[model samples]
Target: MSSVKERFLRYVQVETTSCEANECCPSTPGQKVLGEMLVKEMQAMGVSGARMDEHGYVYGFIPAKGKTDAPAIGLIAHMDTSDAVPGKTVPQVIEHYDGGVIRLKNGVEISGFSFLESLKGQDLIVTSGDSVLGADDKAGVAEIMTLCEKMLAPDAPDHGKICVAFTPDEEIGRGADLFDIPGFGAEFAYTVDGGALGELEYECFNAASCKVTVKGVNIHPGSAKNQMINASLVAMEFAGMLPPWERPEHTEGYEGFYHLMEMSGNEEAAELKYILRDHDIRKLDARKQMMNTACEVLNKKYGDGTVLVELRDSYRNMKEIVEQHPEILERAKAAFLANGVEPIVKAIRGGTDGAQLSFRGLPCPNLSTGGYNFHGRKELVPVQAMEKMTEVLVTLVSVK
Candidate 1:
């Protein structure tokens, strides 16, 4: 059996950082590389239908060894890391953490006082201080891979048909765009992309991305009193009109907010990009309407058509879908208990591939990858947590 640490270290070294601006499916060639690698690895594990599709999605099936009548369960994980940072990672292993601050060579510190207290006494795998650790879903990938290898053994317990998919561009929120759901033939699926151990999530925020463009007329300073309209200032005004306390930095646990992701402008024109999120659908709609109202008020003050706001729905909460099939959560909880880990059921403040997959009729839920502080230089994951997650996967599949 391949250790999860070895598998994760090897996979994260592949550098599969997805691109949000890319028009293609996988978003990066590195995704294709990882997909092809997964295909080969799956085929070696005796999984049938192991193929990397034209769009760089790696999928395969492990036939039922004993009971062929059981419902087929899907195990999924993404191949790409977040585009927030580079993914050319060199993982650092800290064996037996002594409950103090861990200083990364890149001049960052993971202080024991700041959430690191929970991970004390565990072996951690972190980045080399320059890039993300890629454990966001790569840890998921390694866990799924290890579980498949175990199930393929001759003495393994009986299981239903198990389907596995390694999707690309999840970091860019396009993980499910090219997913072959019907072809996958699984009644339900689980995405191994959550943080920490024993995290089983079905609720996620209703997400939307907005682009606000402000147009202004520039004039010479001598005649700038009433003739000039500064676009940057107007953009700032529009942002300030939103509730100041409602933001990612100030809110937590079901408190939705409008996050201004990027803002750039000059006197002529300025653009502000934002991501709006709320777990409650009603509040989500209200948040969008708030954006419209802000635009309306700004336009009223500076003539019509001065502000243009574009809103696009990204994903929705999966709670309604997963609640209908309570057995999935129950089975996961049982599996976690059997593995000596208490399940932490919570609502994800952000989105996951499972959220999109659930709406696509797969009824998928998110599972933990034991990773912490993802998408930056401080990303880390516990080796023991990864091993237990793999065990949880095996237990879930083995259960009738």
Candidate 2:
């Protein structure tokens, strides 16, 4: 069997970065490139139904080797990387890390004082400084591939029928938009797409996206101070009116946050984009209402039509769905412990494809990929942790 590291390295070179502005199902052609590769790989491994659909989803079935009574479980991962950066990754390996600082060729550094400090004694795979490592979900794809290959081996333990899917556009939050849950025929599913070694998450933020547009009267600078109304300054004021402590940089754990994702302005107009998140449905609704109130206050100050706020719900927390199928979580926890790793059950600060899938009638939970600092230049993954994660997947499918 090919090692997880080798599989991951091969997957990341495919350049499957998702495009948020695209209207297509997969959202980018690169996703199809990876999907085709996955279909070929799955077929080579003896998966009978390995095929890629027109929408770029690759699905296959691995029949049970010895058992016929166990429930069919689905293993899923996204093929696309985040559009936050480029993903034509050139990965480098650090053998037997001494644990100080790793300097990239492009002047970026992963310092020991950073989260990478804990990975001191392990082998690490990182980017070459100009691109993202694509470990966010590619590591997930590798884990699933490794597990499927192991299941086909003669020495492998018995397992129920397993369904596998490689989805696209997860980074842009449309991973499950076209998912065929009923056709996939799984009692439950797990997305191997979380961070760190033993992370297993079922709860994700109830999410929304807001856009605030400000219209201002642009006057000549020579006209005088009283005639000038700078729209950019008003946009900054709108941002400042929110509670400072509610921002992402200040919160952790169960604390929800309002994140300002983008801002652009001119003398005549300005637009500010924000993403709001909370695990509690009540708090999530309140946050949207708060944005409306803030817009009202600004409108009152700048005139009725000067400020407009548009808020749209993206995805809700998946806990409500997962709670009904508690056995899924229990089995995953047991699998982790069986592999000699402690299960770290926590709430996801951000949304995953599992969040949407759970709402779509699949009790999907997020599993760890053993990657850290994702979607940036300093992204890294521990070799040992990734191998352990692959083992956890195999164990989850094989052990009763």
Candidate 3:
């Protein structure tokens, strides 16, 4: 059976970046490739019913060594990597970290933070600065797989029925879109996709995808004067209208932001895509209204049909649902403490598959994979944390 680190390294080599441009179920074929690999590996570990569904979701079953009266726990992690930075790259393994400024290569360093102080003396896996290390979910995947391998051992500990799922297109926000929650059959689940070693999160931002379109009349450059209304300029102006202090970089700790995700077009037409987020539902609604208001003001400046704003809700805070089932969090915290890790219960600034899964009646929460700097070239994971997390999963599923 492969170790967590080995599985992580091998899996990261596969390019599984889920494309937002694609409308397909997976949005990328590499997700299917990784899904197949997960199935084969699980089957090799003597797990039953390990198979990838038609839409590229992988599911497997692990029967308890002895039957007990405990909820069937599901362990889930996404199979797709973010398209933010190139997530398809081999990681540079550091056997031991001295922990100062970890320079991957010339002019590239993972420094300027106090977080590295804790990683000293631990084994670290990092990217070469050209691409992301893919630890965001792959580390979670490895931990779950390693946990399965241990559960199948001759002297394996007792656990209730185990359900494992690997989803695709999580980065594109469709990971739970095609999810077959009923068939998976877990009373509750935990997504092992989070940063740091001990993060246990249930609350996530109320998310919405915003699209702003600007249309303009164009004329000859020489005849342009006031006749040619520049759409791109108007789009920029609309962006300027939003509070500049209310962006991702300027905010933290329950502070919401209007993140401009994408913007493009010429003077004749332009489109700006943003993701609006807030922890409070009222504030989330206000943020949406703010966008619509901006569009209204811009339309008055140009014309009635000049600017258009479209908003789509992605996910909501899982706190309300997860709070109803507090035992899951209690169990996770106990498991973390048992494994010599502190449980860092915090609210997620971003949404997870757990946020959606919880609202879908799974009462899901997120666990940390001991990874950091997700969705960027600076991504890395601690070796020992992954191992501990694997143990944590074991204890979480183990019937006392």
- Candidate 1 lDDT over residue span 182-217, tens digit each: 988899999999997889999999999999999999
Count clashes in each candidate, considering only residues at least 3 apart in sequence or on different chains.
0, 0, 0
Per-candidate TM equals 0.98, 0.96, 0.98
Instruction: Mark the 10 consecutive residues where model 3 has the least summed lDDT.
Output: 105-114
**Per-residue lDDT over 90-154 for candidate 2, one digit per residue giving the tens place of the 0 to 100 score:** 99999889888898888898885556667888999998899999998999999999888988888
In model 1, residue pairs whose N, Cα or C atoms come closer than 3 Å (at least 3 residues apart or on different chains), thus clashing, are none
The model with the greater TM-score, 1 or 2, is 1
Best by TM-score: 3
Query: How displaced is residue 355 in candidate 1, in Å?
Result: 1.3
lDDT of 3 at 142: 95
Superposed Cα deviation of residue 145, candidate 2 (Å) = 1.0
lDDT of 3: 0.91
Tens-place lDDT digits, model 3, residues 203-308: 9999999999999888888999979999999999999999999999999999999999899999899999999999999999999999999999989988899999
Ranking by TM-score: 3, 1, 2
Error of 1 at 343 (Å): 0.8
lDDT for 376 (candidate 1): 83
